[model samples]
Target chain A: MITLSNLISRIPGGIAQGIIWGIMALGIYITFRVLKESDLTVDGSFATGGAAAVMMITSGISPWIAVICSFLIGILVGCVTGLIHTKMKIPAILSGILVQFGLYSVNLHIMGMVANVSCNPSKNNVFITMRSIPKAILVGIIFAAVLIAIMYWYFGTEQGCAIRATGNNERMAKAQGINVNNMKVIGFALGNGLVALAGALMAQYQGFSDVNMGRGAIVIGLAAIIIGEVLSEIIFPKGCQFFTRLIFVIIGGIVYYLIMIVVLWLRVDSNDLKLATAVIVMLSLAIPNLKKGE
Target chain B: MLRIENIKKTFNPRTINEKIALNGVDLVLNDGEFVTVIGSNGAGKSTLLNAIAGVWLVDEGKIFIDDVDVTKLPEDKRAKYIGRVFQDPMMGTAADMWIEENLALAHRRGLKRSLRQGISNSERETFKLLLKEFDLGLEDRLSTKVGLLSGGQRQALTLIMATLQRPKLLLLDEHTAALDPKTAAKVLDVTEKIVRKSQLTTFMVTHNMKDAIIHGDRLLMLNNGKIILDIKGEEKKKLTVESLLEKFEQASGEEFSNDAAILG
Candidate 1:
């Protein structure tokens, strides 16, 4: 179990998992970090992406292409939330909830005739059973790498800095000639795109896309980001240095999955996993506030 | 270059806690004019600048920048025309970003922001030259985050940023009030240099009556809701604190009781 080859084999898998969660953490980072906007759209948009991917793939599109479509659709869902917040003057939190609820029905309807689109391993189109694991890992790495590069470059730009300034102080952003609304819209769109990419990748990795796949995903993603921030604060007391926060996001995801694995290892009773995950997320949320107050 | 005619604003309208912040306040600024405003704590000094900057929709009157109607323009929309520095240093620039990045945002005024990296080599050179003129040693620290800067340095940087785009009207609302006397004087000098060099139309509000009278070519005193005294030209040249105080009492018929305003 502890052999060199075995450890090497696990590296690819661990990296893939970390990157998969990185996508979701990235989505959370945009709303939480850049715009300082709390958004629940990730919960629904993630499922919306998975559902859309499954429906399209089953309807004869390649699974690979389906993933791209899901990402684009995720951006659209983010736009809807932005529209509601900007045009209706609805609070960001409420707008996210409204979108999440609406997407519940929308996600189910995307399944065509079934309640869920089960990926039959026997009837594989794009990937074989033996190659599926490596393929998923490869895809996850590529997606995470490309998206991470894009984010790194984007946030370094003037507009990207404006988005960050808006998060820091909207009034100051306006005083500097930055259109805060446009920055928020861009952040929203980018956040959802990453979430949908996560959803699409998840569908391919698990060989299924359920209507409720994205339930509580927002909290989980947030949990990863929070854990990462906590870890990072300890390592670098001066806060994020360049892409260190993104690294924490990846680390947070691995910590998240490892905790789940430990729970399973300890023989947690059936249906208790959800409760445990919720407790973990709640702790992550509360811990940062407590630290800040201290 | 900047004019306000009968501008009015009331906070919490039609309510028990209602307040008439600005009551038909009117003022004018000529091209390359430097004017300072002094008022009591709640004497509509800030409200006047806020109105000019389109911070809130006015209840009445009009604001014009070189004869363009801008009373209804939102705060962000007017950023191209007005550059404002606030009392709080943190309120002017993004502390999380590097000084150069914040400068880039200011330098890119009226330019479209895309996903590509901004701050070209030429712009960086320009920023270095500009910051060097401030003599704050900020030229070598372009990558340094603004949060690391002292309060004085931050305010100075904000001053440079406000004047970067050569705005039609530069609004300095107590830009140096938070600084110590020494740092405040230095910032005031930098401010004067920028305004003089840019030939910018400037409206600066200050609580220190002496600063108002000393730096700017003209000084206006505000009381309840209007300019109580406007002193400039030869009369301004010969004017002193005692004479200005005498004029305030003559115009308002009320003794200026603000000790901080007089003492400063």
Candidate 2:
């Protein structure tokens, strides 16, 4: 029932949103793939970033400064989770949940006890807005490119290698004199910082920050990562380099949005989108295990 | 140079599962002395090694490396002077990492990891040479993931990694016990070569009685959470599997009954 023009019109907006989610997915990849942890902090930290950025911008702060502040706040949030998991000896998943539960109040306070904050692009010079979809897409692509570059460079360094090794094998890392707990803390901080950065940008792009914006952010991030990994395996059968894997993660996000657009065109109820996403992610996650059976 | 004075460790104390892992253990090792440790199941052999490696704080006692008291230090802090290889071949190396990357990690052991590039071009050359010495065709596969390696190759790589930074003390917790006989012998040969080459003060725990008698300058037998026998110098050189069994009976006042220890 959807015309070709309708589908074409949705591409730019979908791409823009996909790019933002791709950045969020990169954060998840750092924790899920690099650090080998299932961190639930992103769900809360994403909203925290949106709250921080919207509040700071509404108070006459530069958008760039607001983004940085959001990232720093996210790092603190991640540190709290890491400390709970490491010092308190709680399991990583439980620590993440505890921090996420606590962050709801913190996010509400940051938004001045409100569930939502709006940034009117007409009244203020916002960095990116849905009004100009093409510009938003360009800005999103640039951010993704810059972030992937920084991550690639950082992971090639010795401290970065230590983090990777700690994620791969904690016992071996400790034996090699690498402080595994410190590495975990650092990794969590960095991952959440990036997620917060994405949330900040996303608030500007969408013209509003809502506490519920991050409710299912973790699932979307995982979906992006899984899509990226599967796509990379199919496209690059020779295996990918570190940087290439990251590039594919962003590409995966874009593809995920495209798929969603197609599903929407088929007249699926918008309210059931989350259910569809969950099923997609579940199938993607089980693909490797299914292959092993063969 | 390592010393353990009156160390004690008890697991699940005051519970039905209470077990004494180490009971007032006392030991001293001169610099560069290779000591082989042997014991039956539940005899505190691995416990002694774990205590020395600072896996956890001893319930009571003092530990020192080169006269530097390290009793209160955590495992990572003590790692500066200690190198260890575990019984599981998969425990000593990160399976997802490339062989060179794993080596690079070991190369920086005890050194602060900074923003410097990992595995420089010159360092890669050194690693290639080192891998070539193993002659297992690993030099050609420096970028290969360690998970792809066989158990013996992993054990050999672990041995190399343990000695890369030349720790003050090396602990091998049944490092070769997981491999087949042929692979075990090859790995042991490499272990001896590296140990002698670096002159590392080493503590090796093994179930094989013959291996205990054949290697190391000194031998120790643990029984019931205590060292029941300690032998060294000319006396250790003359020991055989039968004599070690006899010595275990004499020291512990019980027959050597562990089948794995006897037959391995």
Candidate 3:
């Protein structure tokens, strides 16, 4: 059933999916690389974004407005996680997990208590749709480019640098009169906002949203980031510009999806996709440490 | 410039590892007065500095920095009036940031961070001039990540950063203890230069007896969470290691036993 030409035809779809997930990985990069906190909120917020966007689109709201709403909602979710950690003194990891656990019900409520929602692309002119691969890829590229530009500019500002410092060294940040708690809260918000935006785009592309759409999303995001970082190191051993790194993260996402396409072409069971991803990520993460040992 | 009234802190209170780090300690400092603290391992010299820096809330006491009660202020809030360098050089600056970026962070200490460029062109020039004065060659490496710098260089940079905003009080917690003697002396020289230039109120804790005797306008000896001895002015000026050791033994009613304090 699997053939080289068949695999080749599926490549564009994989690339489109990769770009969407790449945006999600950018969100993860904020907390994982910048704040140095692993937030599990993306798993839930991602689905929430899809749910919100699909519900809005079906309710006659424009796709752009729907995507923006999803981003704001994700930020609100992140703020809850942040406040729970900073104010309630819960550990960062636990706070993110708690909010994520609670978001399941919230996402269902947003989807009118349904487990899944869909927008008929035939009637609605979605910003991105898989019906036309070229259009979908073009829209994804534009979104990625604009988001990357904003991130590059924002992280160069005074407040942005403070956030970076907070992640780098909390004690030093506080010593420099930075409100580290506030910076962490801001990081979580911005990170999840981007994650939700990616979710909205994915929903539009797929024409449907499901409650479980974001299962294992964090691992996938990490895979993209790790792949991107490793590749970037190989391509630019001395390190590259921040803007270039951002672009590489998107490329990493595409590469990950392309690998999945290859695995599919090899006739691996679809249910084993998650297993393969875990192995790939584990190996990607281990390669650097292994090389260092040698 | 600084006042402490009956400040106390107990680590792991009521637990098997309970330690009274500070107990009913009180002190006052005039503006521009530099104070050096000396103590044995458990004498709470660093704890006293931490109390003033508001690293944690005191158990029962009021602290006044320039006559403003700040006993309840959190660490970051207190940072507006305080500058600190830790024993670890890495603690004072973000390692991943560029040399100039770290300076920019320090330059904006106690000021509201806005959407403005983190480091302006004029600010970069000012930083370059300042770094040039230190002669660390860091002036030429403004864009280099601070992690690439040597420990001594990092400490020197930290010293400059602490004084960048002209903090009301400077706290140096064994800042040079981890460096080699050569580097330690270099950092100490930088410290003295900055303190004398700005006349900033300063508190320095050191294990080296000679350093304690050589620096500061006044000296404090902490023993078992208490200030057992306080010497200043002409008395501090005339103090030698031998005489200071005798004074410590007399006040604490115990033999001076910390090897590093004696040998360092």
Best by lDDT: 3
Q: Show the lowest summed lDDT stretch of 10 residues, model 2 chain A.
A: A120-129
Ranking by DockQ: 3, 2, 1
Tens digits of per-residue lDDT for model 1 on A1-294? 335564455555555565677678888899987788899999899888888887777677887788789989999999999888887889999999999999988888888746678776566554312245677666666666677777888888877888888888787889987888888887888899889878877776667888788888887888788878888998999777657778788778767766665555556773888887788778877876898997
Docking quality band of candidate 3, CAPRI definitions: high
lDDT of 3 by residue, B6-74 (tens): 999999999999999998999999999999999999899999988998889999989999999999999
Q: Quote the positional error of residue B51 for candidate 3 in Å.
A: 0.7
Off by over 4 Å in 2: none
Write one digit per residue (lDDT tens) for candidate 3, span A36-114: 9999999999999999999999989999999999999989988888889888999988999998899999989999999
Candidate models: Cα lDDT each: 0.83, 0.91, 0.93
Regions more than 4 Å wrong, model 1: A1-15, A124-131, A230-241, A278-294
Task: Highest DockQ: give the candidate number.
Answer: 3
**lDDT by residue (tens digit), candidate 1, B1-264:** 888899878899999999888887777889999988987778888888888888888999999999999998988888988888999988998888888888888887656777668677888899999999889989999989898999899999999988888899999999898999999999999998999988888889998988888878888888876777888887887877888888989998988877888998
Q: Count the backbone clashes (under 3 Å) in each candidate.
A: 0, 0, 0
Per-model TM-score, in order, reads 0.93, 0.98, 0.98
Candidate 1, DockQ to 2 decimals?
0.67
CAPRI quality level assigned to candidate 2 from its DockQ score = high
